[model samples]
Target chain A: MAAKQNQENLPVVLVYRRPQFNLPHRNRLSRHFILLDPADSQEPTSSFLSTYAQSVRALLCVGYSTITSETLSLLPSLELIVACSAGVDHIDLQECHRRGIAITNASVAFAEDVADLAVGLLIDVLRKISGADRFVRGGLWPVMGDYPLGSKLGGKRVGIVGFGSIGSEVAKRLVAFGCSIAYNSRRRKPSVPFPYHANVRGLAADSDILILCCALTEETHHMINEGVMTSLGKEGVIINVGRGSLIDEKELVQFLVQGKIGGAGLDVFENEPDVPKELFSLDNVVLSPHRAVFTPESLEALIDLTSANLKAFFSNKPLKSLVEIEL
Target chain B: MAAKQNQENLPVVLVYRRPQFNLPHRNRLSRHFILLDPADSQEPTSSFLSTYAQSVRALLCVGYSTITSETLSLLPSLELIVACSAGVDHIDLQECHRRGIAITNASVAFAEDVADLAVGLLIDVLRKISGADRFVRGGLWPVMGDYPLGSKLGGKRVGIVGFGSIGSEVAKRLVAFGCSIAYNSRRRKPSVPFPYHANVRGLAADSDILILCCALTEETHHMINEGVMTSLGKEGVIINVGRGSLIDEKELVQFLVQGKIGGAGLDVFENEPDVPKELFSLDNVVLSPHRAVFTPESLEALIDLTSANLKAFFSNKPLKSLVEIEL
Candidate 1:
């Protein structure tokens, strides 16, 4: 009866998730907010949202569910969006900006995991860890003499695309391995010690390895294209832990096939789960199923962060990891 | 004529390498020393050594060529043995100790590369980087909904078996990843900040991961046996960048096959060019053909260090990485 009374006084927050996606930490979240999930209703999603979530002040966006302007129209009272993903490409940022709806993301939760994967991929590519494992599994080591020597990570110049939390974490880890860090971001960060380039092409030209960890914004889409690859040169390696659309996939395939680029460790693709068949045969490439930020620890952290953001917003306290509105 | 005079004036150094093994940085070393290689002679190794290398004061032991008492007997005037490998197990240290011959190894040259590999293997195992790549390459990602999430490296308790150069380097890199480090060396290092364990079992019991980076000696061989693995428990991971003999291979295979231990990332196996066939099919273990210290950069460093050590010995200067013989 006490719990029910407490729940009755809690703020109403609509849970915006796909039908297949389950809201993590549902039990923990239910204590502070009355979560209005359309998936749990007998009525259609549109009817369910129009009936109960019309007056919802906060919406928690789960996974990559598209948050269109039309969806925003349904929740007229929605003042805040707490995203469970680090990247906000699916969320209609412009629409939210127009309505003055504050946004917070799971960047702090996902940054370290993404950064860990990025460094892992870089080391895997440079040292041929995956390739060597494949060779050993294939029983080719005795038949074939020595596995070809891999490049050392120490003293390599690494250029990071997107000097955000994830990119900064990667730079921090790689610095310990003696890599020189440089970055290209939307704007130069004045206090950062790493040298910054205004453009991806300029960064690629100066780097032995290029790690992509940026957002999939319209201006940044296909940012690592043919020209960037050409500048990166044949000996350069690419590690993409960011959104798939960050690189022109077709151009990357061509470059990799032609040996125009040395190697790649890709977690994301332009079309995920449908990787280029050509890449499957390349020993120089490591393909992951877009799981850079999906560790159990990070997922748990995401849940806590999502709930915390929503709680902070309700209490009129400062939000953690808020997305800066350009407008 | 001047070049010829310079070559003749250079100190004679006997190069003892396997017949199939070509010395790296040969050109660089040749400029500084009169390299007497038996592999270049039509005469047998013993005969060649007796004829030309009898008075050779310095011997460069390359590529794990055994420097036994018989081999050392060939060079009675041998003052110093400069090893091209980090581990001196291949060299007869006892014989060198009895003869009062100083020894230097490429530990300083190989430390960074070996450490890089140790960390690489740890990340590969923990994050399933190689396994995920295999899944994507085998076209299993789309068929399988999602690859299983790997454990996060952050907050993992990593216990290093050695506190030498390579082990220390591994600790340094892992610290940046937020892994708390402890170590078990032959003796506790007074200078190192990480907590020390007197035995492998103690370290294993406290650690989530055990990394083997110590030299393979009679006392240290098979140190990470059943007891250590048992202490490590079912979820523990072992990353070996040290010699294969540091682990009991049969026990490891059994533990892995039975799920008694979590996973492993093995670079050196008990037998080179021949890994256990059972391990070939296991997804939990990553196998590399003992090439951890063979990076092109490290190999280059090895050659430079070998030349430096030999030059230092002949010039009466202190050696860069002299092995302190246990008297």
Candidate 2:
């Protein structure tokens, strides 16, 4: 009876998420707050939000569900959005800014796992780990003599796109493998030691490997296009752990099929779960099903971070992982 | 011609290797010395060595050809043996010691590439890079939903077997990934910061990952056996970039099949080019056909080091990568 009374007295938090994004692990969120989830109710999301979330000051957005201006208008009392992902591109930054709403993302929680996968993908491409495994599994080793030699990872110049938390971690790990690092971002970070390129093409031209670790936004969509691939040259490799739309998929396919680009390790495709069928036959490419940031450790960290952010907002304390909304 | 005369005047260095091991890159060694290859002659190896290599003071042993006492007896004038591979197990070290012959190996050249592959294989197993690639290639992503989440690389307890050049290099790379390292070797390296286990089983008991980087010797053969595997627990991963015989392959396969051991990343096997068929279907294991140390860059470095060692031996200078013979 005491526990039920305490739960009823807890601060209310509106949970906004798509049906597919509903995870069982998220039930932990209800321990500290009264979560008002429309999915749990019979009414439509808009009607449910209009009924119970009218007085809700905080909203937790799950996965990549887009929060448009129309959705924002429904939650008139929402002062903060706690994003359960590293990227906030799906959220209406302009509308949120107009409504004087604050935003926080899971970059701090996802950075290490994302960076680890980026390095793993880069190594897999350069060393042909996946290709060699296929050769051995196909029982070709006894007949084919030795598998072809892979390129050395040491002494390669790696150019990272985005000098964000994940990009910085990738640089740190690759440096230990004897790779020199450079990066391209919206702006040059003062404290980072790696040389910065103002554009992706310049970074590609100077790098033996180009890794994408940035957010997907209007200016950054399709940033890795034909010109960038050409600049990366025939010997360069690309590793993408960011959003699929960051690269122009059609041009990338042509470049890969034509052998214009050396290889690719793609975790994100322009249209995921629908990767280019052409890439299926290529041994030089390693295709992952957009799982770089989905490690159990990182997911557990994300849950803790999301709960902390909500608690901070309700307790009149400073929020964590706040994104600087560009005007 | 002046060049022809200079080549004729160069000191003799006998090249002993199987026909398959005759690499084109080794022709570079001919510039500095007269390479008297027994395989180049129609005469039997013993007859050829006795005839043309009577005055040869240095012998270059290529690949993993067994240099027995009988072969050593044929080369009466051989004062030094230059091994073109990392492990000198195939060379008659006891016979070489008895004859007061010095030894050199390509460990210095192969260490970085071997270390790179070891880390690549570890990442492949943990992140399921190869498994995920297969899933994406088989067009299963769209139908199967999300691929299963992989364990994080960071915070893993890694135990390195052998603290030699390759082992040290592996440690350097894994440290950047936030893995805690411990090591077991013939002798504890005083300068290494990682805790040393006096035995393999103890190391396995504490580590989430055990990497084999030691040489194959009488005492070290089948070092990773049933006892060590059990101590490693069901969640422990094994990575062998050292040699195949270092592990009991039959036991390893059984453990993997029964889920008594977690996973494995094998570059070397108990038998070359012929891996156990049972491992082919296992997703947790990453297989490479004994090509971990065969990167183009590493091969180039080996050629340079081999030539340098031969030149140093002829000129009475200290040889590079000299193997310390245990008396």
Candidate 3:
């Protein structure tokens, strides 16, 4: 829905964090005297509502920090709730509907950076690059080392679990590696140029490498389980740039120990920051802490798009990624 | 010169080190009561013999070993000298030429393995996979550490020096990365599809990365000097898979230290087993002990092909890669 147009000195409170306004186009959100650090009391810092709830006609916050119905009730004047992050999982949609507030997000800027990470992890696994480096630096070369043997990625089968924007971008990068691409999603994306598999297990079975790039929803939660791991061939590798909840952590650990699958490269885990010790034991795995979309370019794009998204909301234009208001 | 068609049994001395032969065709030399380790303490090894003065009609030897003409003068029966390596640089070629002896070398089998190493080094440098692993494993991650950043080679400009068989194979593998290829050689080889540069420095300046794939010779000695390194841009990366003598070690070190050139990947060093200590200080350089052609596949091929070359020599057929004799 288009934002309501009431442009006569409408007081709007900028939410949690603001982008650095040092560039050429910095005054996009200047008219809305932003509450830079909104909630400094209950959360101690980095929350928006605790400080400016009374005067907040509009609440601009990120998706991670909580935005409760109680917090919205305090902002009785809040008309727009714009989330800076892509996902709206943390927002209370039911409350937003009751309060008659509009919600929008920044998402498109994330896909490119996330997809680059996915492809980089894939190459890291196939080439045994991480393992070799450890071998070399540990003074293992010509000492405690075996041959640095590995197969090239010029002719391998790659299976992508999601056919969304990010997954398709991953496929495009893998295409340059001369690998065949196969993907599985909820339904076949008709416009997709590559082959689609109806089942993730089958995709894993046919593929030399399996990449997880799907969204984290109830249907995909713990989808890569024991069966999926077993179905993957002996030399199969797994790369997950998607949510950690998509994988069954216990089953992954067991598979890694038995070498049921060749290796894995993970940017996320079942829990944020609470990784198992066994995962680090195996030299075959490469791990990152859910920061795939953390490039400088991606961050700037996200802030610009999110600011534009908020500006569009206040100006009564159709929002880019609108969701139900959690009033 | 052809092998004698009807020769009586004679004492044949194998005076040097070579890979063990398991070929049935080597029996051609066996008819003359061939010796595996000749007890000629006073005689020269295979490399230092005259064409007609040595008692041994044929010699089999590895690279980096010596053969002398003084020993050849004591025998008065030498006819041929064969190398079990691709390079026959240590052999006394002109002395043998003066006496009409034939020399053959094994070259083709070693090309593929070296080419594989060149490509492996290329990927290792561009991806920065090694450095990433080091950062993660050093307890630098979970709380605080720098990210492992790298650039993709999807559209980089690659310049190859000494575009021979190995160089061309590297080009084939790099094509999958969507890289544009430029090359420098003694003369333009029309068979290759890539563009040729008349000047080496011009090629270095134009390329995003430079690769050395040429043989070691006087005309090409120290070709990659301070001037060539300066020609490369600050972000340019260089990979050397050819002979170490082709590059100036001190210049490369200085360029890398000053960041005049971005990085270097060296499979061969100017001196074997002794890498410069300064190179170890820089994270940008990757050093390997001249074993680009040390894979199992290439090792087997080298041995099998050398045996074949030896067999062909005793069977009165033209030998492949006859260095000291006319082809």
Residues A1-327, candidate 2, lDDT per residue (tens digit)? Answer: 999999899999888889889744766888888888888888999888788778889998998888999989998898999999898988999999999999999988989888988988888898899999999999999998877788999899999998888999999999998999999999999999989999999999999999999988888899999999999999999999999999999999999999999999999988778999999999999999998886887778899999999999989899988888765
lDDT of 3 by residue, B76-168 (tens): 666777665555556666668777877766556666556656665665566554554455555556666345555556568999998866788
Better of 1 and 3 by TM-score: 1
Per-prediction CA RMSD (Å): 1.3, 1.6, 7.9
Which candidate gets the maximum TM-score versus the true structure? 1
True contacts kept of each: 0.87, 0.92, 0.09
Q: lDDT by residue for model 3 over A63-112, one digit each (tens)?
A: 35667787677677778877766555567767788778787765566666
What ranges in model 3 sit over 4 Å off? A1-119, A144-146, A272-275, A279-281, A288-327, B1-127, B145-158, B162-183, B186-196, B213-216, B241-246, B258-260, B272-274, B286-327
Per-candidate DockQ values are 0.86, 0.87, 0.16
iRMSD value for model 3: 4.6
Decide which is better by DockQ, 1 or 2. Answer: 2
* Per-residue C-alpha lDDT of model 1 across residues B186-218, encoded as one tens digit per residue: 888889999999999999999999999998988
